[model samples]
Target: MRSECPVRAVASGSGGRRSYLVTGYEEARLALGDARLSKDTAAFFAGVDSKRRLHPAVAHTMLAGDPPRHTRLRKLVTGAFTSGAVAGLRPFITRLTDELLDRWPADGPVDLVADLAVPLPVMVICELLGVPETDRPQVQRWSAELFAAGEPGRTDAASYAVAEYMTGLIASKRLRPGDSLLDRLIAARDGEDHLDEDELVSLAVLLLVAGHETTTHFLGNAALALLRHPAAMERLRSAPDSLPQALDELLRFDAPVSTSTFRFTTEAITLGGTEIPAGVPVLVALGAANRDPRRFPAPDRLDLDRDATGHLSFGHGIHRCVGAPLAKAEAHIALRAILTRFPRIRLAVPDERLVWRHTRLVRGLDSLPVLT
Candidate 1:
């Protein structure tokens, strides 16, 4: 796409609705941070008729709103995921990783996605949110279904299910308050500013879903990347201290999110010499941008020493992922633990046999069978 034109318009949907796809690194960076691109889906589709309507709690999330609302909502939960706050959870994450790994069988292949990558982040996020351990399995199921592409009915059902679950959970938190982040968010106040019933439910759902999904895929992707690159894996195994620095390159090499969430232009904007008109939807290909040769030398080759700082894996600008610190902390602990525990871990199946999840937003494996 970049070879032809970095930004180009394409037939995105029925009824002649044209959308833009930004694939170049510089163009994607600019499009992500540009205020001209609005995230307000409600306003965009105000009068459009549709067969299904999203629940208010699902539709009004910070991810779907532009600034002012986005700023207010993000501020309430930002403190819990800051670098210092995440650092405080290192001991907990390390302990949890050890516990999960300890359960692996002594002599057989295990699915890393199910055994480690999926549950590790789910448990961590659930603990942080104070979700009852008993309810986590259902929550995980709903979260997974919400991302099942090409299954609109299932996705819609999952969205409603999770939103209702969060609503009930919030109500429960009010009766028995705890020190978890959810408790703090429920009691949070900025003068007269407070989250209403809908906002509260929406925020909780967002945190629970987004908090773990990206990291889950990231671990799978990182593990696969390491398995493919023996030298990089060996270096990390030899010098555990360098894992943190190498994580960026890992993220760059195979991003967890293939493309960013939808952002439509409020007005016409030019990107990479292409003019995108007002109200046109733009999809920034994060995976494609990360591999743009102009930005990263030998972009396809995984080089741990390469400076991968500007990668758009977590996104850019005001809407950059707030959970990045926590995600990084979890990855560092989980990867280090896996490498240390299973020195001889290798993929059980051939490279061509591994199956990827069928989803547009998330890039992850269906299962990663490995011999440990």
Candidate 2:
């Protein structure tokens, strides 16, 4: 599709909106960073004043926003994820990885999603936000709802449940402070800058939701890629330092995020010689872009040694994931440890039996059962 038609009109999204999808590498790369594209959906949603229509708390996330608002929200929370701050988590993350691996079932089909991938990031983000271990299951359940495509009511209920929980959590943090990221956010001061009540809750939920969900998919996809490609796996095992670059190739080969989040043009934009009119929704196929043969040779095959530097797994432009470093650190350490510990790890079931997430928003395994 990318080679034949880089940009084409599609009638696939919900709410009866005209949509456009871009699949070429250069097209998606440029569109993601395009100023003409806006993330605010007020102009598209039906029957209400976009300005006065109070979007859901989770909707306040900066990933779905444009500048100024994005700038301010990003600034308020940027310090918590600085390279130094994220790197500071290495020891704790390493310890956690070892602990989880040690607990894996000795002689059975272990669901790696439940055993490692899911829990690893969930625990990390929870700890970062000072969420209790006891509350992990509940938060995990609610967070899973974000991927419940075609089930608006379910996702809504899930969002509300998290919002209610965070309200209490925030109130408690206000009373009894701790040295967690939540505490930092609660008291995060940038001269005269700070988060209001809504912003605080929104940011917390965003971090918790995005913090684990994307990373979980990434870990799953990357693990599956390496497992299917033993040469790549063995190479990483012999030289663990190569795991970093190998991760990039794995990401490009199978991006966790199949499509970039909702983007709409403010004015008619021409891309790939296709005329996209104003107010049309645009979905950039990140996974497709990563595999564009015009850009990366042998794009479908997994080449751990490939220089996959400019992959869109973390996205492009200012809207790029802020927790990218932390996610990479988690994936890097987790994958290395998994491969190192279970040198003979392989899927319990045939590849054809595996199921993928039904939603197009994310590309990941529904469950990855493995024999460690």
lDDT of 2 by residue, 1-372 (tens): 788899999887467766899999999999999999999864455565443322277876777778888888888777878889998998989999999888987775799887889989999999889998899889998998867877877887888899889889988988898999888878864235667777878888899999999999999999999878888889889999888877788889999999998899999989989999998789999999999988999999898778999999989888888898889999999998988888889999999999999988899888999997
| Per-residue lDDT of 118 in model 2 | 91
Q: State model 1's lDDT.
A: 0.91
What local lDDT score does residue 200 receive in model 2, on the 0 to 100 scale? Answer: 79
lDDT of 1 by residue, 170-272 (tens): 8898898899998888887323567787888889998999999999999999999999998889899999999999999999999999999879989888889
lDDT of 1 at 277: 84
Per-model lDDT = 0.91, 0.87
* TM-score of decoy 1: 0.98
Q: How far is candidate 2 from the true structure (C-alpha RMSD, Å)?
A: 2.3
The TM-scores, one per candidate, come to: 0.98, 0.95
